[model samples]
Target: MDNPMKSSFWMLCILIDLWPYVEDNLTQLQCNLFSIGPGEYFRSLVAQQKTHLWTQRNLCDSPNDAHDRYISNHLFAQLVDRHCIDDRGPIKLFCDDFRPQNIIVDPTTLGIKAVLDLEFTTAMPSQFASEPPWWLSLAGPDSYLVRGLTLDHFVEAYMYEPRLDQFLAAMEQAEKTHPAAEHHKPLSRLMRESWRSKRFWFNYAARKPFDIDDIFNDCLKDGNASIESLDEETRAGLDAFVEAKMKQLKAYDTDCARHLESAG
Candidate 1:
């Protein structure tokens, strides 16, 4: 099927080329520059050659890093032409699997920190039954300037949605061996429990906790993923649920603080 969007994009580019004076509009110039032609020649060149340039320039020796840089460079180059902000970086959209968050403690202050970011923009819907990538400021110590393991790297990791099965398996293992195992639970189980636990407030209930599983399976049927990929709609719904739950939890915490202050 022809991509009407792609065709429209090319048409816009041609229009821009025909009227270069329109370059006065920075945004229009950006769009024209990034616009992939009908033949996709520039895009192909970036995919095949300039990608190697980025890889070599960055000294990205890892196969994964090289591939990610290539994609990022192509996407970024497109952004330069279109003058659009592409928040999704190379690592986030390319990584295949991610491990469950293992909390790290700051030795000096004894502060416990969770690695997962509270907000993550998802792609490919694979994180439905698994824990998404988390961010970490340090590696369980006061270490600084680690190679590519910074807060920025953490956010980029989530762009490449990891498989649900892989996330689930990590959660299972984490629940067994992680120091904070109590915080670990399968994503599906967590959702069901949250639904169950908040039934009084939400004023709803599934026939059983297992019903959530059935619903997930049914949703997956229409989705273009393996057993592990979450459909975009499902992921979005899950994100909404999470946001609501977070708000509820915050309210409860506030109430508890008030009660304690009054008691004291």
Candidate 2:
């Protein structure tokens, strides 16, 4: 049997590296917005007269940063909806045609010696955080985006706006309870040192909109492989399958609209 973690596997893995509350909120909002509730009213208001949907007055359609914001927010929303924000299980999506190369090394050698140097090849994108070890490059000519949790300082700045002192107070209590926990260091100290360096800024930038495109392009260029290199029959089959799935989704949405209209 073909292993799922091989070179020909295009997999998406969800890391528990995002803000749980923000993720929860986005999930709730998206679910409610698409369901048969107040969200219906909100969508109607935004799409009213069709002209309103495209007008600058639409809050969600702010022209200045709409595209980037949409992409960022959409990623967050998908993460939340798929994983329920803190369930602590890794979710994997399989892509037969989306083969990614993977690199695994012997922990003892730190990857310096010769061991196959490549496994079928699976590319796993690093979360927008720390870089995976250098060994991953040997897997194959594939790309994976890097992503991870925003450091505490970045969260404090624009992401979470809690009273700083109050948050530190809680961290203090947590430290006491978990005594030896890695994060047991006083929150007060962490806060003081947090924004003092490039640690947090570097992390924030990894997930930033401009950085994503750059990372993707870098991987594509480094791979030196063309889409034409894939098995042609497999590529054709994937295109047809995608088209069919999209048609099914459209039909489902149309049916949902008709049901809602009739009920209303």
Candidate 3:
């Protein structure tokens, strides 16, 4: 693993080997691990994270913020309904805080000795693991600062990263020879599409919580559509959903502040 490409290729191989065992271990507890239950847990977690970040950034007042929120929720709900919750496929382990800093490597060989920081790791839909890791580009969502280039731009640029091709090639070989070739094939296709469509951002946002605003806005921009394009009935429903969600977030924040004040 002297080269980054080699290291990443090996990482994917390890992940493929671990996928089945992790899914088997977590299948029973998946429903009970999160307070809201497995199906709704990620959704609720994302909403809570987005609410906190939105409040912290004072983004609630931005024009079209409500629309953005609505679209974000809408897209998220659709994804969850279609691909996430209730999928019978093997679940994959997701480590939210994975980055280069968390990886321990042998200095001479550059081989990965160990991966640390599994504190936030949990089982999630296999499709999640199918998407490319954000660290493949060695950049986070916030690093794309050029006016026109956003997260999608970073993903597109990273597509040409030498390591990604190596990783995918390794995955393809695994698909052909692995006992779980059927499983690996679908994930391989998904990873490619996720990269091409930049759906990786949506998957990332679904888990990152705090990044919902930035990711959602970028998604809307990529789609090249606006709130006005939504049908009248859909718009009405989304408006109502946004209003209620905003009110709930404000109340939760106010309660937390009052409790802090009393403690002080």
Candidate 4:
């Protein structure tokens, strides 16, 4: 129970056990409670997130902010297109605030007895679940940056933890036993690639609004060559879209400030 590695592995196993149930029942639950299809849901969610980020002033103030915004919007559009074309996998069901504080664990056995918060739990695109959970750090990704540690450094430290190999082995065995093992196998691979390519930041950013600026900056640094390789028309479109969005956001913020001033 005192062993952190054992505790983490057990938590991972719990997640593995819960995933299939969530995936299998998602459609039925959606039908019973709401009627929107997953594709439409994804589009709406992405659009809303984009709008929310656009309106936040401090998120895009870095030196490479323009390029970062351009890359983020373009990558998001591509992600949307890809998911729209083949939105066949099971949607990810996760709690937004998945942290140790919310988990009730047995001190003697290091087993999770109950998960407390169900309010923030929801389904998202399977790709969102492809990467490792952010809760591993017990803090937001920005906290690492504030401590002068890169995301890669954080990941490296996590990987070096004891019994990580055993944890991964258990995960692999669990995946093999699942009915949709083939579909789930890609997530394991994607998780590794995400870490290596710094794409984990993008996945992280997708879920957390405040982390977008830092993630976007990291992505731009890591994928600069790939971004540059994009076709001229595509790049131009991305530039125009981001420019317009920024203008709209600034106007909205200004209007809000003026209204507050008048009221005051």
Candidate 5:
């Protein structure tokens, strides 16, 4: 296993490889970024994650009403997708789970032997590569939603600002220590900009659908998170969507129960 603290450097190395495709006309020494084509991928994943959420009966946290959450998710999806919508983005290979567990190492020398879990590894907009990794602080994007809590409820307790500063600081050190190229702009600078610009949160939610609401409530916009915030037509459509999803989940659960009974 790798310590997230030490492994932060390892991730910086990976990000260097995640750099965008540079053309011969390289003029900027900065981490120029890109995003998903039109951002449909994220909106779609929100639907997918919602289906999984209800199907698995994972509604343990009651910090907010489920219907309100659906509305929050729906509203946020519209806002969040914009973050990932750059058509000119260069696609680069990346693995979302580029963290400690997938890294295998030799105990004696502590050298990495292999990296596993490549199923979801694929090309993405290079701006995503600039996203500050979640594991660097060991505070996953799953923090609020998975626990039935909002980030507002637990963020201060975690001293998130300080930990985040430390992570970025470490990333900067790693960048200086390893020069992928002298002309390249600093990756650490790009990462901090990601945080400040909310690109980190949007890209995070894009890849992790379940955390969309958490990020929306905490990062993109705050309080007064009500269905009233949405337009009438949009609200009506979501009501219908939720109604349809409920029936679909019911059917899925029934099928699963039947399969279990038949096996018994």
Candidate 6:
């Protein structure tokens, strides 16, 4: 990271070579020669991996509402997987932990020092990379503490538009100068459209499984998708599943309490 040629600027230069190829079948074939898999294959592979990971976790991962967490994970994982059916891939490296504090800066000169925390980086769906970052040094809609804000009132309650407009204007200016952005649509335009189309919500909810139930219903869902209003297909046997799941969590909680007592 200290090397001038190995900075974030050069890391992003990979896109300059990739954009002209993403939408052109002939160019994509040329890219495959360099070991960049086609968009469709990469998307499908990531989707399968995500689905398997989702199934492996359940109420145990989130104990607050075990039954709801277990069911929502399965149901929403289906919707999240559907996002992968498109040709919009050749995945891009993304970092969910990207935020202000992670980027160290020289306060006197107002220059970035180094980008830390590369551990969270992964090859993710293209949209996840293009959509505007959710961590804008503010309480994102997902982490809002106001009553009712965590429900469908999320986006509206965040009071996001004024800041978003300012960010987009700056982004539009930056995109005009970025070499990689020339072949692709302006990232600012894509981000505004991503927000408008709610693809941003899908991309966000797809990553945060612990908060998926609230985020999916509040932002991603079209209408009532709660356990009570789920379609018959997803609703079937849910009642019994909830009952069995609650029992498991009860045992889990009891074991934790017993261990705490022993430790004392």
Using TM-score as the measure, the top candidate is 6
Position 220, candidate 2: lDDT? 18
* Comparison by TM-score, 2 against 6, better one: 6
TM-score for each predicted model, relative to the true structure: 0.17, 0.21, 0.59, 0.56, 0.62, 0.65
Give the distance in Å from residue 184's predicted Cα in candidate 6 to where it truly belongs. Answer: 2.1
Q: Which candidate do you rate higher for TM-score, 3 or 5?
A: 5
Over 1-264, each residue of candidate 4 has an lDDT whose tens digit, in order, gives: 387755665455446434554464555455644545556655655665555444443344433565566566555645544334236666668677777889999999999999887898887656666665565556656678788877665556655323334455666677676635443454556655555555555556666655555565565343444576566886777656557556755664576556546645
Question: Which regions in candidate 6 have their CA more than 4 angstroms from the true location?
Answer: 1-71, 145-158, 179-183, 224-233
* 10 residues in a row with least lDDT, candidate 5: 21-30
List the candidate 3 regions with Cα displacement exceeding 4 Å. Answer: 1-57, 145-149, 156-163, 170-190, 196-199, 220-234, 237-264
**Which order, best to worst by lDDT?**
5, 3, 6, 4, 1, 2
- How does model 2 fare in lDDT? 0.33
| lDDT of each candidate versus the true structure | 0.34, 0.33, 0.61, 0.58, 0.63, 0.59
Write one digit per residue (lDDT tens) for candidate 1, span 30-131.
Answer: 555544442242233334333233222223334444333333333333322221112232112212223335446687887875544434432321222222
Q: How many clashes in each candidate?
A: 11, 22, 0, 0, 2, 0
The true-versus-predicted C-alpha distance at residue 8 of model 5, in Å, is 36
> Residue-wise lDDT of candidate 3 within 1-264, one digit each (tens)?
297755665455446444554465356346556544444655655444434433432335443576676666555544454335244566668777888989999999999999999898977766677787667677765567435466666657656346677778888788776545442445667787876665676677776554566776666343655556566776677656556557745665565556546645
Residue 234 lDDT (model 4)? 66
Please give, for residues 201-220, the per-residue lDDT of candidate 2 as tens digits.
22233323234323223321
Order the candidate numbers by TM-score, best to worst. 6, 5, 3, 4, 2, 1
The residue-level lDDT of candidate 6 at 101 comes to 74
For model 1, what is the error of residue 8's alpha carbon versus the real structure, in angstroms, after optimal superposition?
6.2
Alpha-carbon shift of residue 79 in model 2 (angstroms): 22
TM-score of candidate 1 to 2 decimals: 0.17
Best candidate, lDDT = 5
Sequence-dependent TM-score of model 6: 0.65
Which candidate model has the greater lDDT, 1 or 5? 5
